[model samples]
Target: MRLRALLTTAALLAASACGATPDAPAKTTLTWWDHYDSGAADQAVTALIARYQGAHPDVEVKRTAIPPAEFRAKLDQAAASGAFPDVVAVDSPDLPRLVAQNAVADLTDRFQGWAVGEALLEPVRESARHGGRFYGVPLRSETLALVYDREVLAGAAPPRTWDDLRATAKALTRDGRAGLCFAGLPEEDLTSTFLAFLWQAGGDLDTVDDEAGVEALAFVDELVNVDRSVPAAALGWDNAQVAREFAAGRCAMMVNGPRVVQVLNQAGMNWSVTALPSGAGGSASPLGGETWVIGKGSRHADAAWELLKSLAENRDNITEFGAGLGALPNRGDTVQDLAWQWDPNVAAFAAQMPEARPRNGYGTKYPQVSEAVWTMVQQVLKGDREPEEAAAEARAKIEPLLRER
Candidate 1:
């Protein structure tokens, strides 16, 4: 079946709940589900919803936050049951899966004249587009950076070059603290961290069988094995654990983004942020963030589009949303102000924005392909597979998926 048809079927399965009632109010209530559970995220989303509601008093928005761990499963269950939300917030990488399953709306009609069209970052917009149709609205975005505790670094600053990073991490890996804390688990986060290195090494994950690929994989293994800068627990650590370890000062530095900065700040930890260490080619980081998508089955398509437009098109709304969530605005103009530049933490992350890369070619199967790469890395980290073997294994697993896309 075509993607749209698949989505229609999923939508029907999920919508069986409301049971037809002619007496229902003429104004539709759109349900929006997201994985943002923090106070800041909630407040940001709430403000956006309120703004949207004000513009169209007839439309009611029911927003709910699902735990990230269970989000995918719940979404799947909703799809199977034909009772999905009217709109959903999805990470760029996972958007493709929904698109493939035909669970999202074709947003091409909604893009024209939307102020968000002018403001959205290109890479973010591209991620939400598939087969010539746009599926989502770019919301808040984030990119990876090196986060370190000022007290641990003392007078010395965080490293700039890849070599400098390695040496600094080695030097800082004393006592119970690790020099680097990265997610090495069997998940997409681990793949994201690895991809930063691969790109830095002038390699591409799509071409994982090359020399740069081997070197990229080896470089991480070196940190885990020879350099001993990473903790053994990293093998089991997911993205959240890496951030937690850094916030607790168990790691001197970590590969993370602004969200981690917000977490550390909330915990009363003293820390600073810097661009990710540069490789031979210089600094690089992956673009990460959420996108707003209308469900393929949404009965109130035009109303959903209006909500999406209000959320992403209004500059003031975007600013308020980004500010509350500690997220950088998707538009360059909004983030180029002197205020953001002067803030050391925000400055470091902003510095890497110029070199930030979207997930390469397999935009849709990003999550699945990423997991395959992580599986390969995990084997190498555990000494169960050599770097070359791991790269080969990753390529073997990813090739078929890429073909499907």
Candidate 2:
């Protein structure tokens, strides 16, 4: 019996030494999840993953594309199950919540020495960092801009300054068409648009009681009150409504992102885009878009990091991804690259990236804070409260949310 056991042990040791333990099950397949289900974006990511797999034949990548609306819920369930993807793509605004939950991995060391690190725009970079540690890598970015009907504007130039925009919007309000449209519903879209105006007015959500905050609220109030260019229904509009209204030519101009331009063009509307109007302080727009992150529970973290680094730093990949998907590139150098700069519409959006501001005090509880502000805005627009009263009420609500964060 001892002789037989010794022989069996020797056989097992030899099998391990010879790398014959079923070849380690051919290396665990890496899973990548993204909230990009649109046609071009899906194709581009498929192609990029194919290229990555081709380069690393030893590693297999499994891709799952989720629609933006269902992404958070799906991710939450996956995380709870310990089956979260090795790599995740999340919007900048949503990243804070993920970070707060300790769901994402710290990527400071992973991104070190990467070309994408140097190429990232400051605003986009700041959005990916939490507590001085980089938590995500910006893959694409965008900012709100004025999308105007070229035929409607006619000889009139797009507004370059805030004062100019107010005047232009007022002028364009004739003929049963609104001068401007915005998403002002109780949602992140409305909060984002409002923040742009606030930032342009030199205000921030964190400092809602300051002069800039008051001015921003007053400015929005003017659009409804003194100017009367924006329709009262705008208070209930979301992103889709704003786009639909603009596409139908019900609004001569609207504050929207790059996707709006794409939608308008697809619908055969004659439109042009310009930078968000500069306010008393300067030009500013709220930064929007997703970042690539590694989940804390990932088993193939090293492989995922490599994939993220490749996707973010490779100029060809960046250009291909952004161009195919109509996403704005996050890299400043990529924005200036001849390939990206050649597209006039893209160039216009890129110009605004420098002034793009991420949400103030971006952390957990952002949604709660956003909801409170939106409610206040809605009340003010509905004539239930004055701007000062609304601002104070919003401040009161947001202060508690911030403390919870």
Candidate 3:
């Protein structure tokens, strides 16, 4: 028996010496979820993952592209089950609600004094925080602008002021084409587009009952009712529909974002973008975009943070993602890339970034306030309520929501 035991020990030692060893540590697999379903965006994300994996062969990133409409519900379910993804891309405005649910990790200390974080655009940087702490990083951002067909303008300059807008729109309103188009559906579409006008008029969600608010609403009333420059059928149009109408030559000008550039280019139309006509308050645009967050329950938080940090810090990665999606990069440095500077369509949106304001300061009650604003907009656009009455009603509902926040 002693001889057999000696032989066994010798065999084990020999095997170890010959390179036989315990299995290597399992490769770190980080799961990522995002709601970018378009082909260009999907391709960009896939390429980003490929590059990341190439640099870190020991790490694997598993990505799932969720549909936008179903993404929120899926996140809620994952949060409840404690099976959250390692990294998630959420709409910037929804960050407050996720923070309230403790669904995302707090990166305040991790991002403290980080150079990349310090370089984010003001509104983008602000949107990534909740209660004065950072919870995410702004990946890309977009804002509204007035897109007009150059051919339709017929040597006329784009509108620069409210009076110019009315006159230009009226002049362009002949034939079957509407002079101006905007999404006015009784949904977030209307709220997002109308907020630009509201802000331009020196009003906001909290000041809807003020004179500025009435001025904004009444201006739209004039366009739709008095000037007949904007058709009533616009009430049912969404941003995509507005873009489609413009592409089809049914609209001379439209209020839209950079994403419409792809549509216009694909349609082979001659288009140019300009800042929205300035009102009493000057030009103001609403900020919109996605933020990258680490899930609260992620077991691989460190790895996730590394990936997130890389994404924000790497210029190529950031610019590629932004340009691929036709959105503006949130990083001030990246925004100066030749890709954006050379492209007039994107440059127009980038120029507006300085004055862009996020619809996020209202905290978790923002959705409720948006609901009230949209309701008021629908009422005014339908001519069911005068601008003054709609403003009063909206203010009453919005004030309570803001107070609750």
Candidate 4:
């Protein structure tokens, strides 16, 4: 037996929250599955596991970490074989799909009543919702921002709007260094970057073919094609590669997340983070995060919930955990915590959270929708079609998918 001895209070709460039986599970070992097992973040997870085990002598936690690429397939296999873990961490966007399939226990009422829920960031909370019910608790959250070299800028101020950003990129381009760089991979990497511009132009994912979207696409196209400020090779680059380029001084500025701080620091680079320049509308960026969910049919459902509550509600735990995990804290209390306010690397992210929104509006079958976005970006960057033409083609591709999903 790994987990045992639920109090009457917790048992009642669990029953109400997830319909978990009050009766004790015959097996006591509860498995926690996630998709991180390397570096500082994984070390934090290990420490968290140790702390939980020490506090509750009877409940033994078995932690399993898999690569992100293999996570979905492995989880699917477990679901089919009825061998799901007690607790699992999944990306926020996947929450809807998991809930729709009834693969995870619902935690709506329990979560809203949880102590930590009060200060939860609105965008973070929204990421955990699906069909009007909450199915997960935010384990980590992140958003994109402008990362730049203070020295490289040579006393120039960071740009605040699209026009200024374009001018800055052009002016900073010199001496073998590109002025700005970003991931242009034909996937979610590209979709997120473009979505920021799309929303900043007062366009939504559903309206990708609208005039605003075309303007956003055209702006990026100009940066790459006419301005020649962004590297052409960006077309084949992903987020990691773009960050690397920035840290190496191949680019003076990058659109990246807080995690880039670690890489830049390790490489002995001086960099500062700021919110990305807005379009005509105002500040807008995409949010990304992982959420903690209880697997359906797990015998240790109550125990899993208990563990989740302990980690999520504790300010010290989540703040430290997010630091190691390359995740920014998702609650106002944590974001406003003195440590975060003093930390330059993450403060920009904290400030940007209120304006950040979930990518593609949290709709089901988002991969297809994002594919249309990817096509639009790639076609424009490759110079094979104008921004308007690409957006129109993308709209044609997505109209049927919108209906199907």
Candidate 5:
């Protein structure tokens, strides 16, 4: 309650800064916010906004790019104060919390009229909806893939099944180099990467304590504790660090998202990517990306939606931004553009899009569930707890969280 009071006060001050007076301009100005703070992604956003303003002279968009680390906390504060910007780019996993709070506008009817709305990939489309209604527009997407060093693998074909992966990793583990590396810390990446393995073992978060889940966790145990193929230090590495380890030749392969392509290219390493190996349940990967949403409090909801359409509907514009963002285009029509299809660095990740599973089904309380899942992963990997015991305890903590939402 006290935090809410402070946020309300802050909102009032911010509102005063934008208040209209006799001398103020009559043109409509939509305030926009996003977390694309650097590199091509930021450049892409700035250019897109400028293009929109150029075409719509009467409407102006004011953009604010927040640092990725602080973006969510700042958004929560804005929601609490009912002072959200007119338009915002939100991470896919974080959308449910805002929807549950009634902080975003319903876009189902608006989406129905959109010419290319049906062209979005199913997982990407599903990630932007809540309660079977649209609340956001997916802008970009990506999923995990296995990247291996060609020379390190010694001309061997990439692993295809669980036994193949284990033997391949063990063989590649020698000369002070680990065979495989993946993000294992207690963060969003950890949960997203682990979900792929869990699903491959025929276990969803809802059945996380089942036999399939135990089998998945036990495989991870064998890799880290028994075979010693994956290093114990993985418990502290995030996605970037894992990429760094791979680039430095300390590891031979890694399970990571598309962004690591840039890091590998800069390092000038010989690499290729493939879909993650299958388990008992078959192949699966997690969907991840950003969505464009309108604030429920926006006075210019119509104009905000129009801007989002302009960003998404045009074939050229969608392709341009998708390339700059280093991810797959959301639209099925544009996803197979010549460059994306031919580029080895991204082709495998692109192929996984149709089957990628979104986390939206976990409900609004997913963040809490994510924490529990990653903690269980860390404990098991560290040999601090047995796989069955850790998974059972984590399942106990997550069941009520999903029910509460």
Candidate 6:
């Protein structure tokens, strides 16, 4: 309640200062669109906007928060209509396509002197860049990890290797808990998990015939069909559902991000997180984050850039935003801050951040490719196809998409 009151006060002050200043140049109104769907995350973003507005009274940012499911479709429609917002918080994976289609502006020049832009962790920066140019600024980042009930795994260590993971999960599968579970429902969520698995097996999207692809799928198949360790309900669950189940004690262990840590802390559940189990490729994870971009049709690009530059220069904004959302810091410098260095879970995740990999290939057709990957997982999970056959079919489906420029 106190925090909400503070935010409201901040917003009112920003709004009050937004009027024209006789001594300054004409005020510019910048339209900003964001898809921070969760309540706390959404609050953080709106507060950030208010802070920006308070500092730069000459620039009034009209912000809109969209539902995540509708964001892409709405943005695409707006882009086609030449009415895209001036500033946008875009999904990291979608930036490549937006840049390719000229829906977003290239930020290379604006990012040059910006310390935050320059100090962004490599994987976070890579998510916003393509073909030697930066198209967006890193917002926040997240990755899948082992979130476990500390009480449940009192004696057993969090899984370290594939063998350990499988054995531990099977051993823990009792007492009304599924042992191990994760989201594998559809589209991005399922595909993101698959990317982590694929990379762990030492395979990447470019190679269709890589044996590792089948190996990874086979492992997941064993967990579901053979070992019966993960509940069949997980096959239809999404990330939120997976987190809730873990928090509710429906599962002893879950593969999810740190965003749920705050809820776990509130619920007073004895929980801890560790790096995802290492495989043949060692520790590797799929990356996810939001990127701030200037839309192609933005008339107030200068004002938009100013807003972005302010956000980059303000490290506190980044840190506070990440803390509010339970997301990882997107910049290397921020990771070194004393606020994060002492937190055990954040420190553990920081150790793995360097090894994180972008889930989407650096291309415009990633959505199609990801759909293919998830489809294969669904087919294999249903026992409708062998891992080898499913992987081959998946690769075949995505080959054409990858070949697109």
Measured by lDDT, the strongest candidate is 5
What's the lDDT for all of these models? 0.80, 0.81, 0.86, 0.82, 0.87, 0.81
- Candidate achieving higher lDDT, 2 or 5: 5
Pairs of residues at least 3 apart in sequence or in different chains that clash in candidate 3: none
Q: Distance (Å) between predicted and true CA of 399, model 2? A: 1.8
Per-residue lDDT of 312-383 in model 4, one digit per residue for the tens?
Answer: 865567645656777786787777666554246777777898768974244666767887889889999998
lDDT of 1 by residue, 1-405 (tens): 699999998887667655743465577889999987767777778888888888888999999999888998887787777777899988777777777777888888778766657566676667677776788887767888888888989979789887898899999998889998888888878888988998888888768979989988889989999999998899899777898988887999998877665678777888888888878656688988777888888898888887877776666664455557667655666557554432457766766665577663475566678788888889899999999988998898888888866
Give candidate 3's root-mean-square deviation (CA, Å). Answer: 2.7
RMSD of 4: 8.9
Per-residue lDDT, model 5, residue 236, is 87
Q: Over the stretch 181-254, how does candidate 2's per-residue lDDT look in tens digits?
A: 99988788988888888888887776786788878888888898778899988888998799999998899999
TM-score of 5: 0.90
User: How many Å off is the CA of 127 in candidate 4?
Assistant: 0.5
Once superposed on the true structure, which residue ranges of model 6 sit more than 4 Å away at CA? 1-25, 341-344
What TM-score does structure 1 among the candidates reach?
0.86
Residue-wise lDDT of candidate 3 within 146-208, one digit each (tens)?
999999898789999989988999989977899999998887779998898999999887888
Model 5, 143-244: lDDT tens per residue?
A: 898999999998999998888889999999997799998898889888998899999999988779999999999998898889988898888899989999
TM-scores, each model vs. reference: 0.86, 0.87, 0.92, 0.89, 0.90, 0.91
